[model samples]
Target: MSNTSTSSDTSGLSAGATAATIALAVVGGIVVIVIAIAIIRCIQKNKMQARNTSMQITSVSAVNVDSNIDMVTIERFLADIVKERPVRFTTQNIIDFTQNFAQKLGSGGFGIVYKGQFPNGVQIAVKVLHKTQDKRAEEQFMAEIGTIGRTYHINLVRLYGFCFDNTLKALVYEYMEKGSLDSYLFDENQKLKWEKLHEIAIGTAKGIRYLHEECQKKIVHYDIKPGNVLIDANFSPKVADFGLATLCDRDNSHISLTGGRGTPGYAAPELWMPYPVTHKCDVYSYGMLLFEILGRRRNLNLSQAESQEWFPRWIWHKFEGGELDGVMTNCRIEHSNRDKAERMCKVALWCVQYQPDTRPSMNSVVRMLEGEEEIIAPTNPFQYMMPFDGSSSQWSESRGYSTSTATTTNESEANILIHQNQQ
Candidate 1:
């Protein structure tokens, strides 16, 4: 009996030891899990704080020169960018590549572009900025470097490198063999296929949409035109020239600018007024560009035949009159492309709506172009007039401005009359 009791006691003690070991392990595991979660939360909080601080510093630095940019921060940002991008070239390097700047591409408001070929036989377009004493050139240089340098898209022009030595500043980009879309679209002999034009339009829209919605920051191109749209060797459209770009927080609906930016005819009508601008401004310019692509002519060709003096007006007249077949007869749009062509016209009209609110987002524009969404007929863009001085004489004296009269129901006719009156 004594031996049996001793064995039972030993087994009970062993069971208790095992149970205690497992309980201790469970407690230890719970503690470890809590520590890991706490660490993760603390790290996330620190990161959020860092981002907020960086944004605050950037906002302040933009307005105050005394508050110098965080060089360390900029260097880090540039370091990450350089990790995957081409290195910055010296002015001498650019000169060597360009053969002493021999082949000039063209000049713009900011600078001249020259075609350059590297020793490796790779070609590039070197945009040499015009030296300026004012802050405009510096602002533009910084804007382009900061915006385009960080962005990468097949539809967006690629900035291979840049140079900022002494007074010489330049941006080197991928060489576009076909040149600007503006050059070919209007060439009488170089008529682009309707399918090709449609592809160009959709590609351009995707690029803009990416800028507005996909980028880390919301970028308003502010200038979307045929001149800014470069055609690659494959005839694909690439959005270029970020000189007029403005950045805003992604969550923000609109941004306020002191003054308007963009080419006159292509600029949104609201840009002339004191209003907060949005990515919609780009939409308006794209609308104007779409119209030009469809018409195969400049929107404001005052010297063209009377019917086509203002391309938008002429096209609008055709659209309203249900004469879409004759709208772009010169382009030789085929029966299959007729629907595509008409959809382009409808989308263009929607984009150039008098009110920015009425315009569809670029994403929506893409869907309509892709035939995913039904396009509604846009209202007559000119039926709604810009609020000018409330007198016809003042309107008449304004040269190109006109009043809304019942007889002038057609906006195109009104613009035609204005052009004639000015002449």
Candidate 2:
């Protein structure tokens, strides 16, 4: 009887322990499932927040683009981006390629560019954006690459790789041996032949046409001065420096902008008017640039004897007087040269028409250059301008301010303002 009681009690204890163990296991499983569900919900919420933030950013950019993003924000955004097409490079790689960035190519509103060579004998140009506490620099870096990466054309600068490690930010591009067009345009020492100049003009037009018509989105190059046009060894022109570029839907013909953009001389008049900008702004700038190329000098000259009259207006006066020879003394009266000069002048005047709608599209400009369409005499670009005596020096009077400041103090301050406003 004692043995039977002891066995029965032992069996009952064993059953109770097994039941308690299973209960504990079930409670633990419930807690694990609940925790996992909470984690998943948290992840979903974070994703939603990110999407909302992106929409907000787009909205803000559409309304007013004040400056580029700060360093921290750009670093984070670049980290999250998966760039499959553009190759990524480390800071060490860039250092090795550039030989510690020894060969300085040039400096601009953006930053200093360095000439680099790879082991494969490929030469590259690395543009390092100016660093600043303001997030606008970061925004410009991203904006430039974003535009370049998506664009592919023989007339457009090719991007190879990028580096964004710590404080270093640079864009690697195929080097143009001949350098910027401005270097040669104003260089009396290396004057390009008339044929070569015409070729460059057409090639540049094709590039701009591509940006405006051929791309998935219409890209407006806010700055189209000679400095931004690069020339390769073969004298082929490729458009570069997209710091002030803006992308719009293919269907949309215009864009709303807050402040101003482009260099003082090359900037369209509408930019100063603070009107709604469009691709035509580029046409207007191209007109100004063409005038520079034709005259082989800056359009506005403060020190000239005729400082009051605008250069374009002066050129128009000479053109109307039937003395093209007097306008640009260098342009000879030879048959081919005269034809080319007259065509370019007419096209430029059309481009710089005070009314934005009067400006021809890049495609039309290309056709006009090629002599495919009938050329019409353009009205004077500055016909409506009233001479200002600097009497009323405020608001509208500021437009007449000389873009070229001789003093160092004013130049430095103007440069800062230009960098903030343009590419």
Error of 1 at 318 (Å): 3.1
Candidate 1 per-residue lDDT, tens place, 125-238, comes to 887877762476567677778888778899998888899889588888888777667766767766787789899999999999999999999898887877678788888988
Query: Mind sharing the TM-score for model 2?
Result: 0.70
Question: Per-residue error at 182 for model 1, in Å?
Answer: 0.5
Candidate 1 Cα RMSD after full superposition onto the native fold (Å): 18.0
Model 2 CA lDDT for position 408: 22
- In candidate 1, stretches whose alpha carbon ends up further than 4 angstroms from where it belongs are 1-86, 304-307, 328-331, 386-423
* Minimal lDDT window, size 10, model 1: 413-422
